[model samples]
Target: MTEVSKITLIGHSGWGPVEEAYEERLTVSAAEVTYRYHPIKATAENVAHRWRYWTDGPALVNAFENLAAVVSTW
Candidate 1:
C-alpha cells in the first residue's frame, strides 16, 4: 500500500464546514490531514503576524515542515 501524505489546513475559525467537507474527500486518498484555526480579525497586520508566527514559532515551524502541502483559506 502507498503511504499517505500529510497536509496542513490553515484558515479562519469560520471555515469549519468547508474544512470538514474537504477533509472527508481527502480521506478517500488516505491523506493525513491536520488543521490550524486562527481566530484573529481579518486585518492585514493580523494576517501577517499570524503567518509569521506560524512559520517562525518553534512548534508550528516543526509541524509545518513535515506537511506535504499547506491549504490556507485566508
Candidate 2:
C-alpha cells in the first residue's frame, strides 16, 4: 500500500479539539501535509459525494495523481 502523506480531518468548528486530538494521536503535521479540512458533516451514505462537493474535488484528484506518479516511480 502507498504510504499516507496527508490526513484531513472532516469536521467543523464544533469538533475543534476533537480534530486536534486526532492529529496529535496520528503525529502527522501540517508541514508534513496533514491538515484539518473539516468541510462538512457528511451523512453516512453520502460522505464521499458531500466531501467532493464541499472541498475542491479537482485539487484532491490532482493530489492523488501526483501521489500515484511518485508511487509508480517507486
For each candidate, the alpha-carbon lDDT, in order, equals 0.32, 0.40
Residue range with the least summed lDDT across 10 consecutive positions in model 2: 21-30
- Count clashes in each candidate, considering only residues at least 3 apart in sequence or on different chains: 0, 1
Q: What's the CA error at residue 25 for candidate 1, in Å? A: 13
Per-residue alpha-carbon lDDT of model 2 for 23-69, expressed as tens digits?
A: 11122222333333322433443232221223444665566567656
Q: Could you estimate the TM-score for every candidate?
A: 0.20, 0.26
- List all candidate RMSDs to the true structure: 11.8, 11.2
Instruction: Please give, for residues 1-74, the per-residue lDDT of candidate 1 as tens digits.
Output: 33324443333333544323221112111222333333334343333222112233455544544442332222
Q: Residue 46 of candidate 1: its Cα lDDT?
A: 31
